[model samples]
Target: MEGDCLSCMKYLMFIFNFFIFLGGSFLLGVGVWVLLDPLGFREIVAANPLLFTGVYVVLASGGVLFLLGFLGCCGAIRENRLLLLSFFMLILFIFLAELAAAILAFLFREHLTREYFSRELKRHYQGHNSSDVFTSTWNAVMTTFDCCGVNGPEDFEDSLFRLLSPRTMVPEACCQSNGFPGDVSVEQCVSGSATFRRNKGCYSATVDYFETLLFSAGALLIVVLTIEIFAMVFAMCLFRGIQ
Candidate 1:
């Protein structure tokens, strides 16, 4: 009975190490392809402008933490304090980062509104069965935000308008080509252009925030994932040494 129990324990440990390493690897691949890829960024932002831009940071960060937790769990099972502690430390750090961000958002009352972004999604459609796409688009937006940083709903609305607004398409000369008629002060031209530019500015801010948030998420994922991989390797070494 004692011999059988020991063998069972050994196998369980091996399984833990093996499975976590696999999970870690899977997470790393996702972090790279889905969250960090530049092309992926454009698709996500264009589809669900509001949802993806805000919380994308957390998705990628937590994913890395999940990988770390797996490593630690496996390391503990193998009785490797060094490897186990390394993962634990990573979790502790991630927890703190999440906590700080959450507190700040709450304290500042920085709520993200999805209305504007969803509107952009609606516009993307060919007008054939576009309603059903909202939730999916919204979820994608949320996922993007999770992996990146989003300012709020307003920010995305502004960004979309900036990049896609057609105000620039309408040249000022078209409005003024008739000449101010009476006295066309220089202020008129400046003010007229500025008025049109305001609309573009809104979109520019929105798009800029979204892009920045996505890039930041990608950056963090790269670093955290690297650590997660190292933890897995360490766990495997311990598992092998156990034999």
Candidate 2:
């Protein structure tokens, strides 16, 4: 009965590791895709330092998971104690790292407020249709969120774009309309007319979008951590049963 249980656990470990390998491959592929940026998605993420760091984090995680999965599979199949031990250590390290990251994120949460974002926006935003990455990214954000600047049209008052284009109060992206350039005329939008202007700032909409993504990611993190625990347990059990 013990032998049978050990055999079953070995197979379970193999299957679970195989799935983890596949997941790692998928993440690696996504990281590569973003890095290569054939679809222009990289431009959006590259605009933010945090988002850019997240890409590398994904790549690192995928590589670690790939290595772990390989070690687990080999250790289970060959009944190699060294490989199993390595896998266990790696998982534990990752678990601890995740806990630390979570703690740090919680502690720094206060720094990520709207005022902070608005200050950053004020420092960097050039204008609508500017060729710079920061301007382009902000344009994309304003357009996607249907919000203007970091805190409405006034935020652009002192912008380089406004300085250059004295007549235009806000970008065309700030127009409230059914289409890309907006159904309203540029003159109307620039005139600060309520019917044509997007009065709200991008902060609220940006927060909502990121909060949803973070919630989903947090849930996924929990699931991954749980799986790591099970994997460590199985690896340890199998290592002991090997003799």
How well does each candidate superpose onto the true structure, as a TM-score? 0.32, 0.78
110, model 1: CA deviation in Å?
Answer: 29
Report the number of the highest-TM-score candidate.
2
For each candidate, what is the lDDT?
0.45, 0.77
Record all residue pairs in model 2 with backbone atoms less than 3 Å apart, i.e. clashing.
Answer: none
Worst 10 residues of 2 by lDDT: 177-186
lDDT of 1 by residue, 53-130 (tens): 443654565466556656666565656656655764665566567567656656644234444434543344221122
Residue 90 C-alpha lDDT in model 1: 65
Error of 1 at 149 (Å): 22
What C-alpha RMSD separates each model from the true structure?
A: 14.4, 3.6
Off by over 4 Å in 2: 29-44, 129-131, 157-168, 176-184, 207-212
Residue 189, candidate 1: alpha-carbon lDDT: 31
